[model samples]
Target chain A: MAEERTPLYRRLSRRHLFRLPLLHSRNGKRRWPIRSAGINFALGYGVLFLISATLFLSFIWWSSTNLLNDHVRAFIETDAQELRHRWGHGGAPALSEAINDRLEQNIDDDALYLLIDRHGRRMAGNLPGWPVAVKKMNHFYELTIRRYTFTTPAQFKAYTLPHGFKLIVGHDIRGRTLLSTVITRTLIWCAVMISLLAVGGALVVRDLFRRMVGSIARTASAVANGDLNHRIALTGSETDLVAETVNTMLDRINRLMEGVRQVSNAIAHDLRTPITRARNQLEEAFFSATSPDELRTAVDRAIGDLDHITGIFEALLRIAQIEAGARRSAFTTVNLNQLLSNMAELYEASAEDAGLSLALDVTPLPSLFGDERMLQQALANLLDNAIKFSPPNSMLTLSAHPVMAGTAPGSGAEKKPQGLEISVRDQGPGMNDADILRAHERFFRAESARNTPGSGLGLSLVQAVTSLHHGRLTLTQANPGLKVTLFLPLLPEAERTGRSTTPAETTP
Target chain B: MRILLVEDDPTVRSFVLKGLKEAGHNVDQADNGKDGLYLAIGEKYDIIILDRMLPGGIDGLNILETLRGQKNNTPVLLLSALSDVDDRVDGLRAGGDDYVTKPFAFSELLARVEALGRRGHNESAPETSLTVGDLTLDLLSREVRRDGQKIDLQPREFRLLEFLVRHAGQVVTRTMLLEKVWDYHFDPQTNVIDVHVSRLRQKVDKPFETAIIHTVRNAGYILRPTQD
Candidate 1:
């Protein structure tokens, strides 16, 4: 019912959409080009660059234009001051003469002067008559005036004289306007060049981004298509870091895939014997048994064989479940000292029955947060292995002690070990280096152990339990015996108190 | 013992039915959760064997919760194909008295079912001591005596004997002893339970004229008075 409630496209897109390339839709149609991250990044960079460039150019234009205007204003004020000074000394006649003198001395020929009587008649200046736009006194204005034969825009300031006469001092400002025009044109050209450069830079950046992403995508797609060997090639750039990380991840996946293949093969190979034996026994009982009792015995034996097969399956399932961390919810504070001693006591009788003496050496240990049963099972498996391989009248030692920070041998230098070190040693035929290396693999048995009775999943289960606790398991050849050690890290305070479920830090 | 078995798988259902019938239990069967819930509510049974996954609208946990909600105190044994520890915990947390994983040996199932059935009838006043033949165990003082002669036992052995004596004359599996006596639920690779039982036997029966603890082949161990 829930499946029917969801639309088909929604269901389909939820799983497969992410694996598809950004440029294409699920139906093989071309998607919006800007959806690509590289193009989007480039477009965003271009737009930002253009906006900032526009703001900078606008500021320059505004400031430069204001500077030019201030220069024009200063010239007008100084010229007007000279005229007013002359007016105070010699009245309108000297003021008029001074204006004429300023106009004559102006090299740029961009000066203008106009003097008017109260009756609105022009006295003397370059202008033909008094312009009506200059009505207020001591106020600056821009007005068009006829200077000789040409009309030009001028900045002017008007002043009232002693006999109600008016004087206007003005500057042409044509050169300033031309300079501003040149600046405006330059700014426009610069803007055009900046835009072109921005586009070019964006294209380069997009290309680089695409190259980096494309290789990774291609490698991923290849792997998805069942080509497990495909890998991203490093370009020796800063992106090589990402490339190396991806490559390392691929290697890990490849190894795990290999492990799965080996496990499946081993399961098939190992299970076939018991199954065949059970079938053969049942067939023999059905065809050749003389009495019901004989048939019953055969059937019972077959059932025993079948139970053995089920035991193997159960062990495998338990290992998988532990590795998947499904039992973490059952975690509680477990005292290692108590657990180890209990295990030793439980196995001491078994060890004695096999004519081997089990010695326990334990120090007072801090409690750890873990599934106590799983840890017990792991310890039991280790002790089982030790006793099984031990020779008659030999000593098997089970030891537990706290490993202080940075003290455990062969632990990573960067890892500060703060956990318990539990080891089981047996004076038996120690395994070679190769066997020790492959001991934890599923269903891996050494040549020496071929005749021994075991499912070959003991160490694998132990490894799984250790991993579940974020711990490490190591096997070493102790001269004439084998020593198996488990280093279980202590859960942090938060995890121990059940306030947080963060996984404990792993120690190598 | 009156038992109700709810299982969807025909093979497992018949196997359990035949086994229960042979064991002299009055059995009521249901092939689906709906019928199982109906029968469970309509009739009274001493023990209920419910499968975790059922085909009908109701599941085993739902029935268990409903039965508990109605203030029914019948012991229920949960059967499931999920053998994970979490699944077992979930079944027990949902008012199940015991849990048996699928593909289990009939002896184990029978042991657990009988244990649950016996637990239900044990609602009487608690006993300070248990007796199987001449052997008497004092619970409070943690003491054991045989026919007037005192026999000392380690703490673990005393607890083991206590579980066996409480369920005297009934089959108790190794797993049950491991869980109840030791408070641990794990399968040891070796015969550790057998060794411990042997040690307990050496102390409890080796010097005695009669042996009370007998191994029930392919099942587990049973504690009963020696037959004449």
Candidate 2:
């Protein structure tokens, strides 16, 4: 009963568990019973397209059929009205003659005519009898009837004339039926075409997205497994931009990873020498000391070596702290003039003791917003490098000046570099071009400077601190020596283009 | 001086206890925070060396806060492996007198503990002028005069001499001087402090017949008063 109650299309395609294509016996490929992404997309688009096409065809079906039926009914009514007028003017014989004249002309090929007399006898019309279906119909009625010229369903309307005489009129409905058949065929063809197109489009789209996302996921997994060089391959499409952005992020990660590895390796490599030397000194002092004084001196030297090792660790910790950016919360406006003056004063006496001339040239600068302690450390490292490397009687110059964004000295096209330029130049044996490139890298000491009694983490710490303060560190050759410049960004300009964005602002 | 050491680590506790005892201070030890809180509240000590991460219900901060709540104004030095500046700030803000990160030299810890101890006991007298064996520092005038001969000293040198003279005969390490005199908590990675102290030494004791400032070997400076 329920199967009969359901519509024809729904009953034909009703989902059944037994009919599901879980296992394809022909190929044994075992296709999934559930709809794939392509099928889902196809169904979604096809149903939408078919619904609209059906609606359009349905409108044409209604208008064409209704026009044909209305035309036939109106024609028959006019003929009957004319016949009644003829009957009143010239009695029954004139009316009968007019009917025979209309039948003889037969303008419409599918037209029908039937006239029944008062005693239900045939009159002057072509039909042998009236249809029994519309007998109870009041004055006008329409129904399909058997006709000699039309094999399909026919439409006819009958009207009662004066004195109970009935006149029936109709036309063959094959044209209206053919018109509906043409509309329904067009609708079915359009639906089939739309379904095929939707399926094809869905397959193409699914494959495209799958390929793009697959490559990225594969690269991501490869990278997670410690293949640092892995990168997503671009397909030269709009998604390439997304791939490019991911590649940029990957590059940064790779660089940071290399930095971390370099730092750890440096910690192991650079520290081992001092540790071995200190151990050797202690052993030698213990085994073959001539006097208490010599032993004591050896022990003191060992202690000194141990202290240097501790100092390296301390510097590493401090750099880690700066890189972690814990000191940024303490940013306050600091007067650079006063700070530099005091620092110059602090280092002046030492330079003098070393027989080096210290020149301080500071230009006016706006108050900076940063941690004073960290900035002081960065400046201290630069000045310390200058002093330590400069020969006696050499002049070491330290200067500060503001540089606007468009006015990067030496080149006018530099962009967004507006900040205070603080430089320390030393007239000593300067680094070569190659050394200057990696000067700020951790534990990156020049080959010739290996014998120098210093940890190479100084400039690394300086760079870390400068970056924490939203500043930059630049190392350049000063002809005869090295020129290290620190760029501390001015406050207002940093806030303009949304730099210095804190976590609170980003999250909310 | 008396100190209460609340450290769960046996090795660190023994090391610190030995250093404090060798430095001529009495010490009490507790392995956990609850016992530490009890000892701290029940008795008076010159200073408390509390470990920040204690293995008990009451951590170092909680104990310190509880003590402060009970109106205990005893000085505390929180020791921790947390070297971050924020952690230090939090430790100090929780009523700790000082914060010293771990892997510290015994000399540094000893110096800070002695400084805190001196601060606590010296709160009563509040001396205006400090004198060490005729090395007189006029706090009001900011002058250092040795043996009736006025020593012209730079302002930084004056502050250094003043600190030494105030903490006379106590072992004042380079770290302490860097923190107390230079206001720099970071290690300078050089003997910059030693150089400044040497410069200060020349002006203060070079011409004197009896040298006031003495370098304690492998430790720090001590201004021993000379008895004629």
Candidate 3:
């Protein structure tokens, strides 16, 4: 029912008045001017110059036309008066002979004269309306004569007379009008020339801008392709804000790459020693092992050492993967209560074996978004450290609960509702403030706990995994022990709706 | 019994060759896996000691794999420096009878080779309870008794005495102690081997009138029967 919309190209061309005929003609003709930004600028300059020149020339033309008319009228009037005087005394023969002789001597041929008496009779004049239009005096009229335009004015003052015999004088202005036309054509031609020159100027500027953009694009492509070594050559002035920002970005990238290289080198160096030790131990056992019991014992102990080296490598790799932000894609809704209960069950036996008691108190917690494996690994590491450091028969308590509205961290200062907090507490050798602060550093053994067996990577791995999940891990002293608390965002559904879910419980 | 020992290091090769000869086994030495494999195939030996990683083209695993592929079950005991879980699994899976990481004890090696020999011939099972000089070990009970007096032994001490008694006259290096007693395949930075051996010596050597465990200078321990 609705009319179909016109094609965009057709509509645009129609609106621009670029009809088919005009387009065909334009295409066929070889135009010296190209219409681009450069051409537009030149055309604008030329048009402005032309307008100014036209106004000035038009003014000159109008004044000159008036002056030339006035001078020619006065000469015509003087000749007419002199002829009239001679004709009135002598006869027609004398007047005719004098006018014809004057006509032969005139150079501009634009001048015309007419003379008439009170009887309205035509005397010596090239025009027929000698004194009829001049009777009212000083009347100007534009007349079309012989396919040309002429201005005619009759002046009563230009006529002089004795009593009943009056002499009328008139002038033609066609020659002055023709001269004004010539001036107009010259000004228009000059305007077109200047406009073309402006187009050329705009083209030069356009080319310069294109070149600058091209170089920038090329450098950007190189950087995008992972050649961090490539840097953009600074073109233009330092004042260019785009150049400044790009250079700053490149500098940051270079620094980051250097840091990555250093870290990998350090890791490789540290890892090689343990791996080499594991290898040499195996060789000794193979040659001298005399009994099956001796050989089996040797192989088992080597595997243990090998497992340690593999653990270190895996921990390093996990940290790097977490830092890369690629694992965020694996995020899913996680039930914190279930996770805590499972962890408590797994670690409680190990803790008791180490002479440490593990306690778990789980309250209602909204599910969180996270990778389950990574979260479990992180929590396991934390618990491993807690149980390892705790003295014989020390209690390690793990609890998860909603950070109740009023009792939440920052209390009323926080914008959102309370988050969910899970904490692992141990009644063991608590670290000082400085050790707690440096606890998350890699391979950093606490001065007080240096005697303990650990690789010192547990807490660092926890920190990396915690930050990656957009959660916060904080360490605080439990007066006589160390407590680690993690705060994670509550699930979207249970958080904003304020619905309470059933709490899950765990036993020590 | 004739044994073929393939090792690259000169010191290790000579030490092993001497230890094998002293243990009353004929020893043939090869520097690399290629020559070792050639000699192993060309001439028959009771057992072959092949290093897992060798300097030449044929690695220990490759040589072992090639021998087994040709239906040669010559009982290879693989020796390697790569003492990782995966490396051990790979060596065993690649047709090796037994695998030992580097720096191994000569006594353990001699015992394993003897076991391998016993395995090839369907001979009578070796004694479950073994006796050397004044010491007696009950394999079933995991107990050690000297002259009708009961001796308490830790797991490691028990295992050490068992190995020493099994290869009574062989020389075992500290490197061998790390590999066999501690189950470590590489050199230990700590003097863990010496510490454990001293503890064993306190239990097994200190109380006995005739000591069986002897420390050989710059070599290893030798558990030989008393000459009286």
Candidate 4:
């Protein structure tokens, strides 16, 4: 029923498996045979198998034929030696009698003998006459002779005896010839069998390869068609590695796409509120304002709201730009010591005004290559958050030191430091586990920070700047406070020096 | 002061023209880059405010480059909607004296324009010492003295005072102070600039009988000999 359910052309093609065309047109487009890796693999395997099998069979045929020829030559040499001795002891007549006796004693009837006189006339032999082709004495030759009713091919050796009599000793090789012919016939049959097996094996291999890759191809096409949920099923085969890697990549892409979607949604929600608020305020002022002062106050407030909205827009655009790595070109050799101190001094007065004491603990460090302005901005955001959350008289500790890669916070490893760790700890109502996990998400305001007057993009911008520097940002609860650490890797000398210098602005 | 205003948007152009005229400046208006360039070249203006994107074939940068190439030394402040740092760099690299992104407060524009106008007049001679009322700033010694009484200041504070004293009687915004004094460009989330100015005021104004650094509501800070 299933076979009948398929299209008629598919069913017809399925019946003639061997006649399957390597190249077929689908939807009016010709599919190239070479495009199929399975077909290429099968062809290569089949050709190699055929060549090796032919060589092996040829080796067997040559060795077997040589063994049979050697056996015949050994027998002819021994028989000729014994007959020559007989001719020497009993003369030509004795040799002729001996040759007849051997012929009569031959149970297999494969013996051949011939004795020629000085004038080259055959005296005693199974052959009709001296072979005209056997012109030399003491040499082996092959000739046909009449054994009984049938003529058979035989190997012979002509030997010169006393009184110029030539005695030719030979053996009938019809059995050996038949055996060799049978071996040749069997080898040919085997070659044909091997060729058939190779082709069948190739088909099996190609089928397996296609089945493995077909799953992946189907999943990819499904994804291309907007079905991102489709995934290649793992078959526990060697191809599972590739399938797993592809699945992992798809998961990452899905996550990124989801992030983009969420950001768009958040932007719409975030921007709409202020815009609606501003519009409503202006509309209300237009209809109700009876005095210029009242109208002016309403307009000023609207402008302030608009400015706040603009600030949010600028922050979002900067974060997006930084995440896109567009600001990397502005990287330069920044003196960390000077930068940290300047930032500390710049923000110290603000922290003091907020009734918080700011402490800076920066160890002597080498120069860092980065966009000083961006790093400063990130630090400013962190400090801003710290001061905003901290209670009066609380100490905001901003510290920086060198750290080795892979070493956790406060772990003292003896290895050389490979990166810089800058942390800001604030004594505030720290975030919970869930909020900490999502603190860097754009527009994610923590419960403790819900009342704070911020656009909720501070940490996101910090995250963007950290990632742009090939760094990692982590937030951990510092027992009574929260600690935000930015771990920036130290670029190697080659990378630092290899950067192309951007053109500087000329003074007018 | 004579000012040239080049903007394509009628709303923004009329608003800026009205503001400049109200501020007692002779203003020349052009709706496109072609007329703007012609007016800028034909007249000697104290400042030229050029919009980055114009309707005509010529652009703000093109006019700027042509003027600079001809050694026209009038300071040009670029008004643009492109707010990226690279865009600002491109504008400045093309001989723009300053860049103000769109959606700007008129006060910021006026402040920057007045600053640019003052810069053209102040470039004629270099002064070793600047005096604003009783406040004196020694350029060679990096010393600031009020009423001939030496006032010790930190290195950063001296630079801040020098910038303020040089642009005396001008409304200097927080961004200007941040860029000119700290050599950094970015908006601090909080009023950090206010804190710094307060610190400066504590030393320069708190002890003195006269206050020099006065905050302009909704604008920034202005350092004058006397308060308004």
Candidate 5:
């Protein structure tokens, strides 16, 4: 309906420019195809070419006529002088005889001569009074005359001569004029006909190209508006590279969307269990508790269950925040040593309470650029997992050292540039190949560690935070347990040494 | 003794009602804030139990706020499912004399009610001590005597005994214990309340020849003169 309401030009402009059509689109839009640009250019050129051709041909015709007339005038003047010379030497008889002899030799036509002794009469030529006898200096004039010849009938001109003699000459130019007219008319007709044909051909191509591109555009619009299932119909013969590129991009986007859907589902499914459990526990206590002691016990159990639920929720929220890619703008120069040391202190008691030996081997480190809270959370989760999964009393070692200055592969780009490498090693059951690969999958629990109580969101959170920091997290087995190492680029020494305590901004 | 309960959940209301009934107190239930407020204003309840979340334009917090606004000194025990410390702080700040979380055991509910009831009575009766039967208490001196012998008590135990005695024959709810004696502030959702109550009971009741504090099965406790 909207398409019908909007003129065609509007739709075209909008599709081309990715915006609403401007005011000029109110007219019933012209269905200009993509080939319209070329078609318009060709049509305009052809029309101008035809107009110029007509003018050129007409000029040529006029110029040819003028040139022939000039030649005739020159010949008459010379011939008349010769006639006077003849008349002066031998009187009128000689001139008449000469004129008659010249006429008899002109069997080809377009030739004429006359001799009149100062009288309005022709003497020695086909019957024709002097044509265009307007006054001239020396009694000379030029004019077209209709006359009859001994053999042919045609138009001729009489050039009156001096001393009682006139010379009339004629030669047939009508046949030549007819042939030139045919040639000029044929050339003009060919030019105009070709131009009209070119315009017709261009319109056809414009309409064809419009349909082809419009179909693809419609499909793309549908996809942009969230109909991921829509695919461009590879219509027309021109669909080669464009169709291939669009299809590939759509395939990748669909895959990414699927992954997001799966993660969302996992969060919903796993978090509900603990929340329901806590609710049920509370309900039971409210109904059956007999004394203050029983009531307090019930409330305690419910609170504990709620704590677990909150834990999962908090972790999920943190991961989501990291994934939103906003933390990049909040990056600041952070002291890795101080950040790690703070975490080490915070988790030491927790680790001690869990009967795990936790150690922080901090090598004096340069500053790094990142969100402090996110880094702390990521590191804390890693350490928490190590402490939780490892057997009680196992030694867990944490170390941070600079990536050797020039150890990067072939590129000297980041050579010897100070970046910190942090690793956490545990002495409990180590992860095998399968576990290591899928550890970052949300809600994925290791087969050997299923009995333990956890939501399996830790590694995923760690991965998200690491990505936010523009860092890499590698998981490997430490011979006896799991080892997770993180590499984060370091800020220059000046920024790191400037200030120690600043909260990271969340705006980005 | 009489008690007033204000809670929105039907399940929780019925369970708490049954427990208090078994504890031998006349129990009144109000589903939401308006009805609860009407009840609190019209009736003289030994203790008023309030739920933080309620329907009908009045929540536990609102009821407490209104009650305090009206200068009604009836002790209110606020109940909720939220156990966060911030929530507790807000509830208490809103004039809730005591606060408790949901999924509470009946016993803890009764203990809190009794404590609030006793605290309310003590405010009324500012005299240092009050005695019934052979048990005598000196509030000013913080002393207790049973059969003419001085009996020492922990602060929590003294507070518990004081609540039981104040409402000597009434049933208290577990929500009561959470709010009053422990001043739990937030629901720990742990058995810490029960553990503390048991220790108090062992000290206050177990050593006595005539137990003044009697557990009422699913209901709370009753402090009465020796039956003999």
Candidate 6:
């Protein structure tokens, strides 16, 4: 009961006005903080609304009382004017008669009229006498008068009548008193409505702000305690912008951590076999090799195994480098047709030696700005995969053609943006959708490819190269085999706008 | 030939030191960057094999840079675990004569060392034709003749023979042959260079009474006239 009388504003100020506790304690079992948060909200809003309502009511009170007083004054002035006109026509006796007549005529009304002589004797009117405090010369006044049964506030003006007579006229103004009473009652009701509205509004705003802050706090606490999977719930308010930024940052960190774990797993899983085989070969040669030639052969085989491991490391490093896009510095305006022709010439014989026919259909097109060597390597890896996978007498096709980038998703029509599509299709066992999806992943090899000689990083390298050149690589089933297509942008816009690109080797 | 090898790893140091010593080159070893820099600046050597990363404040690249800054032009082969092309470029840009990635075959290292040594010791005048006893190669006509008999070679075979003749008495590794002769940088799983060299030998050395391109034990091939 004592707390209820203390005023909500005082209670809130003494308690939780600015003591914003952002994070809850561990185990999250405490409920007082949330309850106090609600109390604080109500008290704060109640005080704010009460102050504004008081100010607005005070203004209305002053203006309404003022208007009533002005109306009373206007009536008094008109009555005085009529008395003066009577005196001008029929002398001082006539003016006195008119005053008496006016008093009698407004007897039922709250009108008050008084005729005073030079010595200040009251002749007639409901007022006991002209109050001495009221100024005698022409002046308007608000005076309290004693009536027969009651005292009421009155507004009047004193007028000097004909031949040393004074006429003071006023109205009772009981209606102004009633109006004040009603306004005061309205003010009280307004305060009550504000209290209710403050409570309702505070509940809504407090729920929104508190829930938002609470969600952020929970997510931060989870992340700080090393639970990286936790994320802030985004209901997409204006404040969700912050959640979006934080979530993306967390996602990036999570991806990097996952990448580190995957790379370590790959290293442990992939390099262990080669190292063990090399170590075993060395041990076997040390114990069992009877001849120097046999020992040399064993050592060479062991070295070969070690070399394979090193090659894997090299491939990993190259992929990392390509992903870094450091080789973009070596970009030049490369003739794609000429580059493909050279690649064809270099690997065509090797493909034939494997009893596979290599076909190339490269049409002359606009040159692209890219790392020439990286592109060649990408093409070479594709051809190498084709040769490795294709059966004898099967043909491999390499073709380059112009392509168009499609419109945004959900569009009914296709949009054509200038680009080039280069594909390497081989006539062999193609991969399924799942394999195609994971093909670009590092150290991911198909089951059939396990028997073949590869580090399983060829496609990953190709993907890296394509991304570095701002291109995309997609693997599709070529019916009989796999078809790998690379879509590349024509020229980097920076090169076109800034004129910064210079060919690494100029050939006219 | 005199060589200075600056390697921090004790095992790698002993391995390279033993190989170079067995190859008949005088070698001085430094186990740390400080000692390596001290020896490299104080003594003259036919070739310097330096690891890009080393213990102590003085690193291999810094030492090489300091030496080059002081007008030291000794051929330096940089060894690094950093195997990417950018790393290789960085090493060469820091004045390295050649860059070799770690976990390298000793044959590759020894061959590069011998080549750098010979390249350092050779006379400055450019030679259009090279002669080793009765074996002769004409650079202008792109011809190889032994005892006044002409030898025919393919384009790649001709480039391979030309490199051997240019570094006539020096060793050349299989990797060097692949890079210099074929202009290919990737390492193949198979020993393809051996097949190409064998083919070249059938035409260049088989018809002759004496073998010219001799494969060194655990090293590489040396294009020198064989002694009877």
lDDT of 1 by residue, B122-207 (tens): 88998998888888999999989988889999988998899998889899999888888887787777788899899999988998
Q: Which is the winner by DockQ between candidate 2 and candidate 5?
A: 2
Candidate 3 C-alpha lDDT tens digits along A1-508 = 0011123223333443434233334458744333344434544554566567767887888898778767765665576668777778766656656766766776756545555555867666565554333444443433444313534333233444554444444445566667867987776566556544644555675576657666667777888998877766776653246765776677666755754674587477766766777777788888988998988887877776776776676566566556555566567788777778866755665676666778878775667777676777777777877876778977999887777466654334344445777788888888888888888766667887777666667777777777666667888999889999877655466442332221112110
In order, the Cα lDDT scores of the candidates are 0.83, 0.78, 0.68, 0.83, 0.68, 0.78
lDDT of 6 by residue, B1-228 (tens): 889999999999999999899989999999889999999999998889999999988889999999999999999999999887677878999999998888888888888887787888776888888887787888888887888999887666777888998778778987898677765566644345675777788899899888889897666788987675
Q: lDDT by residue for model 4 over A1-508, one digit each (tens)?
A: 1222123223323543445455667676666434435444544564565566567766876887678668888998888888888877988888889988888889987777788899988888777787778888777777776666887788878777878888877878887668667766765566556445645665677788878999999999999998888888999999999999889777756755665676688788898988998999999999999999999999999998999899898888898777655688898998989989999998999999999999988876668889988999999999999999998899999999887667864455576678898999999888888888988988889987878889899998888888877788899998778999998878887876564322122110
DockQ metric, candidate 3: 0.02
Ranking by DockQ: 1, 4, 2, 6, 5, 3
Candidate 4's residue-wise lDDT over B1-228, tens digit each?
999999999999999999999989999999998999999999999999999999879999999999999999899999999999999999999999999998999999999999999988867677899889999999899888888888989888888888888888888999888888987788888888898889899999999888989999988898989643
Candidate 1 TM-score to native: 0.77
lDDT of 6 by residue, A354-422 (tens): 778888876555688887767877887888888889989999999887665564322322444467879
lDDT of 5 by residue, A296-347 (tens): 9888887778767766765665565556554455566777887787556545
Error of 6 at A95 (Å): 45
Residue A78 displacement in candidate 5 (angstroms): 7.7
DockQ of each: 0.69, 0.24, 0.02, 0.56, 0.03, 0.17
List TM-score per model, in order: 0.77, 0.69, 0.42, 0.66, 0.47, 0.61
Per-residue lDDT tens digits of candidate 1, residues A1-508? 1232123223333433464334776899987534445444544564565566667766877897688779989988987887788888998888778877877898888878889888978887877777778778888898877777777778888888877788888888777567667766765666556545645665677688888788999998999998889999998888789888888777767755765676678778998898999999999999999999999999999998998888888888888666655678788889778888888888998999899999888777778888898999999999999988988999999988777776653334355448888999999998999899989988888899999888889998988889888888899999889999998888677655544222334322
List of clashing residue pairs for candidate 4: A113-A125
Q: After superposing candidate 5, which stretches have Cα over 4 Å from the reference?
A: A1-180, A187-241, A289-377, A390-422, A447-454, A464-472, A487-508, B1-228
* Candidate 5 TM-score, true structure as reference: 0.47
RMSD of each: 8.4, 8.4, 20.2, 9.6, 16.2, 10.2
lDDT of 2 by residue, A1-508 (tens): 1222123223222332245435585787777553446545655676777777878888888887888878866776776677778878976678778878877787665666677778998776766576677665335554566557555666666767778887676666678878977887797678657756765776686787788788988988999998979998888878788888888778767856765676688888989988999999999999999999999999989988987888888788788666655567777788888888867866776777777888988867668877887888888888787888888999999898877776654234334436788999999899998888888877888886787778888898888877776777888889889889887777674563444322111100
